[model samples]
Target: MCAYAGNQRLAGVRPRRPGPPPPLDPDAPIPDDPGPLLPDDPDDLPPAPHEPSPYTEPAPETPETEPEPV
Candidate 1:
């Protein structure tokens, strides 16, 4: 039981044969395609002037100070 020492299944040494299951990623995105994946390249289309979202955190400036005479 000493093919080279320690734990190949306690040194009986026959556990290294698992290599043939990985070749399906040719650009990967076709699980079955029933027809709605639309991006044939109008510049990949998704940016036509919807610009109003700078992460929105600008509403905390309330120090105008002029209401003490009523």
Candidate 2:
């Protein structure tokens, strides 16, 4: 079996460390509530055009076939 390049590391090699987070602003304005974008009243909305769904109606029953004699 062959060894990967990442598996072989030099004796004194240390992993890099992450820096500290930046300070926040105290005087920033509080976010306002984003209200419903759609109209509250149902009458305001346009009526949906009707289209018959294929799956809405039950499939037609198939006639039973007579069994074959042995």
Candidate 3:
């Protein structure tokens, strides 16, 4: 108990070590830095859907093109 917090800081009933940090709201609204991840920003948002990476090699089956006119 650290001697009852040093007798409550010599009877001053002390308990406040946090005062001096509230003056930076100059229209505070500028927090958006996320445009540089995939292929160096090629529309950075198509590479985070896991659960199918057996050494990654299973996306090649497109051979059915035969749609006649109406």
Point to the candidate with the largest lDDT: 2
Query: Backbone collision count in every prediction?
Result: 0, 0, 0
Name the best candidate (by TM-score): 2
Model 2 gets an lDDT of 0.69
Report RMSD for candidate 3. 14.5
Candidate 2 residues 1-70, lDDT tens each? 2333467855666666888877878998889989898899976766565744444774468966879999
Angstrom error of the Cα, residue 2, model 2: value is: 20
What residue runs in model 2 are displaced by over 4 Å at the alpha carbon?
1-4, 29-32, 36-70
Question: Deviation in angstroms for 68 in model 1?
Answer: 20
Across 16-47, the per-residue lDDT of candidate 1 in tens digits comes to 78899998889987677677687888666665
Shift of residue 55 alpha carbon in model 1, Å: 8.9
Worst 10 contiguous positions by lDDT, candidate 2? 1-10
Those runs of model 3 whose alpha carbons end farther than 4 Å from true positions after fitting are 1-10, 25-32, 36-51, 56-70
By lDDT: ranked, best first: 2, 3, 1
Taking all chains together, the TM-score of candidate 1 against the true structure is 0.22
Evaluate model 3: give its lDDT. Answer: 0.65
55 in model 3: Cα distance from truth in Å? 3.2
Report the candidate with higher TM-score, 2 versus 3: 2
